[model samples]
Target: MRIFLGWTLFPVWSGWAVTGPKEVTAKQGSPLAVSCSYKPGYELYPKYWCRPGFLRFCFTYIAQTNGSEVTVTQGRVSIRDNHTSRSFMVTFSGVTTEDADWYSCGVKRRLWFNPQHSMEVMVSPGKAGARRWWRQWQRQHSRVCLCLCRLPGRGERSHHRAGIPGGVSLGELHVPARR
Candidate 1:
């Protein structure tokens, strides 16, 4: 579930200063929040959030950061802030293997600079049944489109980065069959 909470910064790229949940856990289809606060000097750019995995170059711009607030318009992605905390909430209706990835939230104000306030979202199946269901569904359904299996195997998957980190790369080895 990719949601746009508006623009926190823009074109300006820096690094993450502080972030939240440290380590968050949730069951399939549950709500998730990946939040962070940039250095006082900079803010997050309200860019449209994108899907977890894809085969080609893709990106969506949502809005702009007015001052400290961002407005995002994507599925279930939302931004909430208080004096002490700011974060992005990612909600999924039916969690699948496709929903797993290490999400990064940051801002890029310009091309010359790097993004700031980067955070990682580690999404995993809450239970073995959830994972098994996802695999069964995929094995019986996938038609060879774009895959996000950075470490492809009989069942394991990976995320495809859009035009970043050279897109996506898979490992040489695969995992043993899960029984």
Candidate 2:
């Protein structure tokens, strides 16, 4: 049961102060991890790894760290903050297809504007090799690629960074379905 919301818990981009990999891939039954770094002054803000729904609303928080360097864990999800390195890490014990989605590494801010790093989490099922449709329009039946884009708001041009990230038109990660 997936929930869809209209509003976002955090906007896609505000200042681009945080940095992280645009995508993270993992195999089923294996662990996955991603790290995000922030500017020095933001060490006191809470850092989170969450799945965002349509309209960028954060639907679930897999893991989130306190405003300090302590580590937080919830079931299979874990998050660690390193204030000295100005970085935080989010990890999952056993990844499944349900974990694949558009996620963000963000800092909770006082104002509405929060610094967020967007990333796509891809979990490949029981297969050693995977194929993806890139830069072309190939119809996929099982699944479709979900990309995150921030539409231009007021004062921002309609063409400003409003397309797919990394400029890659990824269709889907496909593997042979079991009989």
lDDT string for model 1 (8-98, tens) is 3332223344344444445666676555554553444443223323421124422223335544435545543332344444333455545
Candidate 1's clash total is: 37
Say which candidate scores most in lDDT: 2
Query: Which model scores highest in TM-score?
Result: 2
Candidate 1's displacement at residue 44, Å, is: 7.6
Misplaced by over 4 Å in model 1 are 1-13, 16-24, 44-71, 81-94, 117-179
The list of candidate 2 runs beyond 4 A from truth reads 1-15, 127-179
Weakest 10 consecutive residues of candidate 1 by summed lDDT: 162-171
Model 2 lDDT per residue over 1-179, tens place:
12333233224335368889989999977999999999878999989887776656455667877798888999999899899999999989988888888888888877755677888999886453233333233332223334333333534322222233332446433333222
At residue 103, give the lDDT of candidate 2.
Answer: 89
Which residue pairs overlap in candidate 2's backbone? none
For each candidate, how many residue pairs have backbone atoms clashing (under 3 Å)? 37, 0
TM-score against native, each model:
0.42, 0.61
